[model samples]
Target: MRLPSKALIAILFATAALPAAAQDTAAVPQSATAAALECGDDFATWKQNLANEARTAGVGEKGLSALANATLDQKVLDRDRAQGVFSQTFTQFSERMISDYRLKHGAANLQKYGTYFAKGEQDYGVPGPVVAAFWALETDFGAVQGNFNSLNALVTLAHDCRRPDLFRPQIVPLMTLIDRNVLPADVKGAWAGEIGQTQILPSDYLARGVDGDGDGIVDLRNSPADVILTTARKIESRGWKRGEPWVQEIRVPAEMDWALTGRTNKLPLADWAKMGITNRDGSALQDNGLKAGVVLPMGRKGPAFLTYENYDVYLEWNQSATYTLTAAHLAARLAGQPAFDRGNPDAGLTGDAMKALQQKLHDKGYDVGGIDGILGTNTREAIRQEQMRLKLPVDGWPTDELLADL
Candidate 1:
C-alpha cells in the first residue's frame, strides 16, 4: 500500500520549482515531471511546487498561504504504509462491526433524519440504510472522525512518492474549502486526508457535497442533515442504481459449479434458481430478470451472498471484501433483515502464507494485483483459476493444501 522510505532517498535534494506558465490547470497534474515535483525532490521544494499547482487551479492568496503552511508528517507516511488488510472472515467482521450500539443508533437515525433520508432518496435515489450503513461504519456517526491534521496529511501524501497521483489532486479542493471558510486551515480528519462524519475525501467533498440544512453551509461534521444528504449524493454519483437490490443472503446447493461464482460472473436469478440457489429461508428464489453473483466470502462452506449491482457502490466506498460484506449486511440489518446464517468455512491461510501463495501464482502467469496478502477480487479470481487448473475444490480460498500443492 506504500512505497519503502529508502526509495525516497533523493527527497533530501532540493530543486527549483517549475514556472507557472508551463503547468496545466488540472487539479493534479498527470506527470510528476510535468510539475517538476519528483518523488526524489526535497520536502520544502515539494510544498512550493504544491503551492504552485494550487495557484494555477485559481486558488487565492489565503488558500495559497494554507498550502505553503502545510508540512510533511512522517507519521502520515507510517499510517499510509500500515493501511493493510482485513484479516477476518465475513462472520467475524460483521459480528464485530455491527455492534448493538450501531444497530440501535442506525435504526434511530433512520427515524431521526427521516425527512432528509426521504429527500435524499427522492433527489439522489440512494436509500437511507445504504447511506446510514457507511455513516455508522465510518467514524461511528461522527463520534470518532480521525484526529490527524487534515492539511498535513494531504501534504504528506501528495509529497510521498507512492500515491501522489491520488492525494495530489485533493490539495486544491481542500485549499478551496479553506479559502471559502467552509473549513479552517488546520482542520483535523482521517490519515488519508478525509474529513467530516463519513470521512469523505476532499475531492468527493468538493464534487458531491451539498448544503442540506438550508443554512447555506455544507457542514458535514456537525449537521446530521448535511451528512445524510451529502453521503447519499456521493453514493449516487458512484453509479448507484435507483430501486435496486444491493446484497441478499442466499443458500447454495451442497454441490454446484463453483466456477459460476464471483462478482464478475453474473447469472440471472432464474438460472441460479435452477441450480437450487434459494433464499436464506430455503424458499424458491424469485425468477426475476435481475442478474447477481453468488459471493462466497469465506469459500464455499461459508456465508453466501447474492450480490447485485448496488453492492458495487459499497465496494467503491471501501474495497475490502470483508468490509464490503459487513457494510452490506449492516445495511440489510438496518432495514430489518434477520441475522445471516454462519456456515462452518474452512480456516483461511495466514497473511504470510497468502502472500507466498500470491507470489507463486504471479510467477506462474497469474495477475494477483500485487502480493499484498489481501484477498481482493483479482486475487480471488486468480485463486479460482489456479484451483480449477489443479482440479481442486475451486472455492477461491487460499488453503494450506493449496499452498502445499503449489
Candidate 2:
C-alpha cells in the first residue's frame, strides 16, 4: 500500500530536533506526601504518586512534569475491558478486516519496500506478510492511529487494579522516551499507550525500535523502512522462527476423533494427517514433525486452519483467537493465499446467551474464567471439555445445545 501521507512527517519526534531544554516543559505539581498508587485513592493524590514513581525511576524533570499533567480517563478502562474478547467468528472478522483496500495496499507495500522487507526477513527471520499484516491491522497502515492522549491512557490504565502489573511497568519506559526526546509529551496514540503506526506500547517502542533508514533516528511513525524493520525486530525478539510456517488453511474429515481437535491437542503434522487432516485444497498434509493443531473457529463445520509453532507469536501479540487467527489468515492472503472457504458451521451463541452458558458452566465447577459472555481461551477450553463429556462435537464453539446440556 502507498505510505499514508501523514506518516512521512517526523511527528513522533517533533521535539527531537529541538534542544533538550525545550522538551518536557510541563512541571510536576508539588505534593506533601507521595501516596502509593492504589486503585481507590484520590485522583490528585494518585497522580502525584505517579510522578514520584517516575522521578524515582530516573525520569528527568520534564518527564515527571508531563506525568503531572495526566488526566484520569474512564474510557481507557472501558476500551481495555471491551477488548477482553473478540466474539466474532473467524470468517466474520477476517472478511471485515482484510478488505479490498488492504489487500491491494499490502501487495503494493511488499513491492514498494521490497528491499527493506527482504532485509528485515534476512535480519530478523519474520517474513514480509507477517509483519505487514500487523502493520495493516494495528493502525490501517498508519492511517488511523488513535486520538487518545497516550500519557493519560498509560497513567489511567496503570492505576486500574485489573491490569496494574501490565500497565504499571509501561509508565517508566514512556517517561524515559519523553526524557530522551524520542517522543513528545503530548504524543497521541491508542487508548492503551500504543505509539506509532504499528501501535506498539512504549515499553516495546523503547526497547525494540530499529533505525531502518540511514537517518540516525528510529521514527516508526514516519519511515516505512523503520517501521518494517522495527516490526521485524520486535517480532523476532518475541520468538519468531525464520522461514517457518505460521498458519495454513486446512480441511478435516467429518467423522474424526474430536478429542484430537483444538490447539490443546497439538501433535505432529503426520499424526494430524493420519486423523484425516488435509490442506484446504485437498492436498496432502505435511507428513512431518511440525507441531500442528486444528482451529475450528465456529465449530467443527466452520473454517479450519492448521496452526504451526510460529503461530504462537500471533497469540503473544494479541490473545483473542478471532483477531490472531484473522491476522494469520490475512498474512497468508497478503502473501497470495486465496480467500478461505466459509463452511456451513452451526449457528453461534449470542453474547447474553453465551454469558448464561458461562455461568452454568461455572456452576458445574468448570472454570470458564468469568460470566462475562466473551468466549475466551479458558471458556473455550471448558466448552470443549463439556462437549467431550456430552458426546457432542468437540470444537470449542459453545453451541445452544452445548449451553442447554451444561
Candidate 3:
C-alpha cells in the first residue's frame, strides 16, 4: 500500500518546517505548465534535496531511484485511517486473544515444538508459552501476517514528520536490505510498516533474524520456528528472566495500601505480603525471591495483579498495558489457568462518551484537558484524581461504571 498524501504532507511540514505562506502557495492547484514550473520552482527541488539525503544515507542508486519513482498511494492513507482504532474492548481484547484459539494452538505448538521450547526455556529462561503468546498476538498462530511494503512504509514514516527522527535511522538499513537482497522489492506488511510473520522492522530482522529451521535463510514469513525463536530472542534482549513468571492474578485485602499498586510505586514482594497481598487462590506470598509491583488495571473493583520483571519484558514486545496483559493472560491460559475473574468495566463508553467522561472528570476538579477521546496521560491522571477524591482505591484506568457514576 502507498502512504497517504496528507500523511506525507504532514511529514514534510514536520521535517522541513515550511512557512505557512509557502504551504498555502504550494497547495493551490495548478495547470500542467504551472505544475511543472512549481515542481522546478519549489516542491520538486525540495523533494530532490531529500532524495539526495537518502542516497547519502546509503540507499544505493537503484534503491534511491525506486523510492523517487514511488508515489504515496491514497489507498495506503485510507488503510491508515481504517487501522487507526482498535475495535476490541480491554475485556474483549483480552478474552478473544486469551481464548480457545490461542490456548489450543499454544498447547499444540508446545507439544509439536516441545524440544524447541524446552531448549529455549533452558537456554534463554523465557517460558515456552510466553514465546508462543507473542506468536499468537503477532501473527495469530501464523494465520495472517501483514501485507504492506516495509521499505515504502519505513521510508514514508522515516521521512514523515511526526516521528522522522525516531524512524530516520531505519531508512539506511531498509535501503541496505533492498540492496543486499535480504528483503525483496515486493515485500508487503502491516500499515505501520512492520513485516513478516512476527512483524519485525528491517534493522531488527537484520540483527537477530536466525535460520531456526535449518533451512539456511532466516525467513519469518513462512517459518514458524524462525518467528518463535526470533521473538524469544527479542524478549531475551529485553531481559526476560529465566524461570520467572511475568505476572499472576492476586487477591488484595479490602483496605490494602493502594499506594503500592503501580510500577511507579514498587515495593518488595515481602512488603506486599506484609500489606496482605495474596494469590487469588488464597495462597500466601511464599518466598519467591523476585520483586514485584501491584497493578490494578481496572481500579480496586476489578482483578489485581502482582507483576514481575518478566511482565516488563512482555511490555517491551508491545508497549500497551492492555496488550501486555492480554499476552500474559493468554500465556497463562495456554499453560492452563482460568480466564481473568474480573470483567472489564470500561467496555461501554462510545467514542463521544469517552470524551464526555474526560470532560466530566475535568469538571470534577480532575485535570483531564479538552475532551479528546484519547485515553492518554491526562485522562488517566483525571481518573486517579477522581479516585483519590472519592477515596476509592486508585488505579489510573477509567472504567465504564466509574464514568456512569460521574
Q: Write the per-residue lDDT of candidate 2 for residues 1-406, one digit (tens) a residue.
A: 3332333122221111111111111222222122123765777887776777678768898788788778889977766665322565677656877778788889999999999999999999999999899887777788877777988987886677765545556677888889888888998987777778887767667777888988988887788998999889878876888888998899989878877788656788888888888899898886665687888888888898888878877766776677778889999999989989999999888679988998888998988777887777888898888888899878888788887776
Off by over 4 Å in 3: 1-62, 79-88, 343-350, 359-378, 399-406
Q: What TM-score should be assigned to candidate 3?
A: 0.78
lDDT over C-alpha atoms for residue 305 of model 1: 92
Off by over 4 Å in 1: 1-37
Report the Cα lDDT for candidate 3. 0.62
Residue 254, model 2: lDDT of 86
lDDT string, candidate 3, 184-248, tens digits? 77677655555666566665666667677888778878887787777677668667777787888
lDDT (tens digit, per residue) of candidate 1 on 298-343:
8889989999988877766666677778889999999999888888
Best TM-score goes to which candidate?
1
Best by lDDT: 1
Local accuracy by lDDT, each model: 0.78, 0.75, 0.62
Residue 10 local lDDT, model 2: 21
lDDT of 3 at 23: 18
Candidate 2 Cα misplacement greater than 4 A, ranges: 1-37, 83-85
TM for candidate 1 is 0.90
